[model samples]
Every structure is written in C-alpha cells, then in structure tokens.
Target: MIKVIIIGSGNVAQHLIAAFQDSQNLGSEIELVQVFSRQTTNLSHLLDYDKITDDWNTLAEADLYIIAVSDDAIADVSSQLPFKNRLVVHTSGSVSLNALDDNNRKGVFYPLQTFSKNKAVDFKTIPICLESENATDFQLLDKVAKAISDKVSAINSEQRKALHVAAVFVNNFVNHLYEIGSEICQEHQVPFEILKPLIAETADKIMVLTPEEAQTGPAKRNDTATIEAHEAFLSNENYLTIYKTLTQSIQHNGKKL
Candidate 1:
C-alpha cells in the first residue's frame, strides 16, 4: 500500500484527499495516513480531527509526502519536513522539482485541471503530470497516480511550465473573456443565458477542429465595416482595445490560410 500524507487544505489538497479516500476500493492501494495544515480546522470538515495536525513533527512516516501548498510556500514547507530521503512531491504546475528540499527524494504530481472547493471532479478524467529526480521514484509516483487517475504522463519541469502558461491562456484568459461578454450583455439589458448555447458550441467545435479552422467572426472574414462598428459600439476604452487586438489577431491568422 502507498501510505500518503497530504500537506495542505486548499482546493487541490482537498480534492486529492477525497480521491485517495475513495481509492479504498482498489484494495486500499493508496492510504491517507495524515494531513498537515497550520490551521487544523480548515481540514476538519474533510478529515477526522485525529488525522489532521498543525504540528509538523507529528507527521507520520509515509511512503510519499505530497505538498499541495501555494507556490511561494512550497520551498519553505518542504524545507521544514523533519525527515529526509523520503519520496516528497509537490502538486504544482509552475513550480519546478528543484523547489523541494534536496534532503528528500523530490518529484512532482501536478494535476492538469482547475480545482474548485465546491465543484466535484472525477479524478479519472484529470491528467496527472508526474516527474521525479530518479527512475525509482518516478515508477513509485506512476503507480500512485494510476491508482487514482486513468490518465498519467511523465512531464518534465520545463514542459510543465509551458503547459501551465498555456492553461492560463485557455482557461483563465478565456474565462475573463466570458466575464467581459457577460458585462456587455448586462449593459445592453440582454440575458447572458442567450449566449450559453453559442458558448457550448464554440467549445465543442474545437474538440474536433483546430481553433484556427473553427474560427468564425467579422475579423476572420476581414469585415472591416462590421469591425469598425464593433469598435465604435464598445463604449469602454479597455473593451475597445481588446476588441481591436483580437480582431487584428484573427485577421493576421486568416492571412496565413
């Protein structure tokens, strides 16, 4: 059995705890022995009070220690681990393997999905990005990852960093665009629900078609009059600048065709 200790009570850490807890069906291949949180109350709702501790010295001896802390705190937290030469990994996309204290066997087990405390996610669908400083530790991480997720890949720190940046563009930036769209709808007294199907279809289309191939808009068609009207219609200077920039990008991309 892989005895695991999770260090954090945030969204990702909570989700991982749930995933490992449910993995008991796999003949208890993965076990959540303990969880460490500075504010033990934060994890009390998820784990038994006995299983949660604020003291680092009380951390149990586990096969792996997964630090799911924030990016800035990873180094400090890992450095504080009392033991050494254990398989210690962090759940971060941007932070490198070097962030962990070298006193332990370092690795990364980054899940390539956005996590929310209220939203329930299927662990099997989330791709687990695994990396290790050595071959033995990599195999161990792979085994643990496979127990909870169906999709797992060996991704280096550099590749993981690139993927993190791309995720910001696709998830974070695209969500911001949705916010702007909702704002525009509110300004015009139009129900934002009216755009739901369009948004769904746009997302579905990209599954089978390249984003460039799926591109459709006044900008893609080089409709200068329509573009100018949109620019003028956007009363907000910031919105107008965004509209012009996107339109130019679409036109430029279309030129390559």
Candidate 2:
C-alpha cells in the first residue's frame, strides 16, 4: 500500500484528505496515514485527532508527503520537514518543482480547479497535473492520482505555469465579471436569480462549441451602436471602463479570427 501524509489544512488539503479517505474506504491501495497542521483544530472536522498533528516531529513515515500549503509557504515548510530522501510534492500550478527543498525528491501535484471550503467537489472529475524528476516517483503519483481522478496528466513545470495563468483568466477573472453583473442587477432592482439560466447556458455551451463559436454579443457582431449604449449606461467609472475594455477585446479577437 502507498502511504501518504498531507501537510496543510486549507481548502486543497481538506479536499484531498476527503478524497484519499474515500479511496481508503473503498479499499484502494493508497492510504492516507496522517495530516500535518500547525493547529490540530483546523483539521478536526475531517480526521480523528490521532491522525492529525500540530507538531512536525511526530509525523509518521509515509511513502509520499503532499504539501498543500500556500505558494509562499511551500519552500519554508518543505525545508522544515524532519525527514529527507523521501518523496515530497506541492499542489501548485504556478510554482516550479524546484521551489521545493532538495532534501527530498521533488514533484508537483496541482489540481486545476477553484475550491471553496463550503462547496464539495467530485475528485473523480478534477484533472490532476503532475511533475517529477524521478520517473519512479512520477509513476507512484500517477497511481495515487488515478485512485481518485479519472483525468490525470504528466505536466512539466513550464507548462503548468502557463496553465495556471490561463486558469486565472477563465476562472478568477470571469467570476469577477459575474460579480459585476450581479452588482448591475442589484443597482437596477432586478433579481440576480433571473440571470442564472443564462449563466448556466453560457458555461454549458463551451462543452460543445468553441468559445469563439459560442460568442453571441454586440461586441462579437461589431454592433458599435449597442456597445456605445452599454458604455453610456454604466455610470460607475470602473464598470464603464471594464465594459469598454472587454468590448474592444472581443472585437479584436473576432477580427483576428
């Protein structure tokens, strides 16, 4: 059995712990033996106290140690680990594998998704991106990933970095635009719920059609009059700027296509 210990008690860590525990329950060869948290209480909801540790010294030996800490803390945390020559990895898309301390074998185990502590996600559908210097370690990571996820890829650090930036544009930036839309609705006394179906259809469309093909807006059609009207309707200087910027971007992209 491949024993694994995860460090950190944040969103990604909690989700992974749940996924690994579920795998263990289903008799998968991978076992989640322990979790390291600076405060044991942080992970109490997920695992028994015995399996969670606040002290690093008490960490049990495991075949793999997954560091799920914030990007800034990864190097420091890995440097502090008491053991050496073991397989260690971080779940970061932008951070390079070399950022990990060389005391242990290095790898990346990035799960490309937006995670909130309140929302539960199905691990089987989450694509896991992995990188490692050692082919043997890569195989072990692949096995571990396959135990929970149906989609897994061997991604190098450079490629992973590019993927992360694209993710921010698609997930983070797009979500902010949704917030703007909701704000616009609230300002006009319109129910934000009215836009839910449109939001769902917009997301579902990309599954079948390319984003460019799915595009259907005044900007896409170069309807200059409607675009100017939308810009004029936005009294908020920031929103108005954003509207003009996005409209121009859409028109530029359409022109290129």
TM-score leader: 2
lDDT of each: 0.92, 0.94
Q: Against the correct fold, how does model 1 do in TM-score?
A: 0.97
lDDT of 1 by residue, 1-257 (tens): 77999999888999998898888656767888999999788887778898998898788999999999999999999999999899999999999999899999999999999998777999989999999989999998999998899999999999999999999999999999999999999999999999999999999999999988898889988888999898889999999989988888888888877
Off by over 4 Å in 2: none
Candidate 1 residues lying further than 4 Å off, grouped into runs, are 26-28
Strongest candidate by lDDT? 2
133-247: candidate 2 lDDT, tens digit per residue: 9899999999999998999999998899899999999999999999999999999999999999999999999999999889999999888889888888999999998998888
Residue pairs in steric clash, candidate 2?
Answer: none
How much is the lDDT of residue 47 in candidate 1? 83
- Compute each candidate's TM-score over C-alphas: 0.97, 0.98
C-alpha RMSD in Å of predicted model 2 compared with the true structure = 0.8
